[model samples]
Target: MNTRWMARSALAFVCCMAANAWADRPATQTERQAMGFDDPAQLVMVRDLPFPADSDTRAPDGAGLGDEWQTRIGTAFQGRTGAFNFGGQAPSIACTSGTERFATATFDLPAGAAIKYVDMFAYDNSSSEEMLVFLLSVCQGTGGADPPVSTILANSTTSGTPGDTVVTLNLSSAPVIVDRYTCRYMVRVNMASPGGTCVGGSIFLDKVRMQYTP
Candidate 1:
């Protein structure tokens, strides 16, 4: 074999081995950046309000909303009476109001984090009403003065029945995401009638989490 040829062949083999090694190893920093995975920030804990402390007149049980963080709505309803209770077992928090119901809560995300997703876990505790309708809204900036970007996260006027149920809403949907920017957002829980005998029931929201994929 010619020495020059042998040297060239050896170089090619070395290059092949290097390529294979790179392929076998997990994605590296440079490779991830090339694939748009650059420095993605992990979602940190934001505000989590369960709602209805003794001070909160909205909770039904008067036990208040419990330890879970939640946004509460005060005398916003015209004829509605009774605090929207967060505490108590099944059947307690079921929506019982005859008219459109609205409840408000505040949530604070860290200053610069981009909220990628919001997950809500709720249970239909009503025995009479088989279904419920609800909406979740988020507001930017502060107070009622701020125009809220509202989305009907869950509209279960037909399906879903009473009992422990899990519903997932993708924030990427048109109504949920609102915009690409990240700022402080509020979540509003609204219940509406879908006609028929309008059964009064309660709904217990277990958990609401915001996922920030920065």
Candidate 2:
């Protein structure tokens, strides 16, 4: 395996370990059941928004990402298949420079579905600097600028390779019950602070999965 793959694998292992540890919690198990979550059928009501395979194709249906509503497909790397940069340039880019560049994608869930968990699988190209945040709601207002952000799924610094960091949020603490036409799940990435080395400066988004029950 290549170095990139090795790094990504190690990161994935760490995430799994963390998830396993969380699974061992009694409160977590009860919450999981209350939300209708099972490892095998966890995604029964999930709605996914994956990056396009390349520039030739368009982002799936309502899925999109960019700083200014631009859909820039990230350049695929050696082992990071189907991975795209959420903010900054692919391969690598100069320091963020403190302007707060970002990449956001939104997914609409079924009407009247109850969301249980929100998970995003992505990472920073460079070291641990970039951050990931989520905003989920039932009735997102009309078109134009981004919606009002309230729920934050993950607000910690990146800690792995460019495509293997998994950020999972348990909505059990604050159950999100959709009563409107549909529930919108949004993933927002805040680029790392500028002035760092060039190699680890971008955020790579691989996939997003939502667990819900209608």
Best candidate, TM-score-wise? Answer: 2
Task: In candidate 2, list every pair of residues with a backbone clash.
Answer: 126-200
lDDT of 2 by residue, 1-214 (tens): 4999999999998995554332111224433332222354332222222222344222344222320121212222111112322234544322233332444555555565655555555656565455444433323455635443233332333555565576655543333555454235555444443332223335555555655656
lDDT of model number 1: 0.38
Candidate 1 runs further than 4 Å off: 1-92, 98-100, 125-158, 172-184, 196-202
Cα-based TM-score, every candidate = 0.39, 0.42
Worst 10 residues of 1 by lDDT: 42-51
lDDT to native, each model = 0.38, 0.42
In angstroms, give how far residue 138 of model 1 lies from its true place.
Answer: 6.0
lDDT of 1 by residue, 1-214 (tens): 5999999999998996554331112334533322222234411121222222344232242122221223222222121234433333432243353433443445554444433334455556554443332333333544456444332333323235566664533322222223325343554444323331223435554444444432
Model 1 lDDT, residue 84, Cα: 39
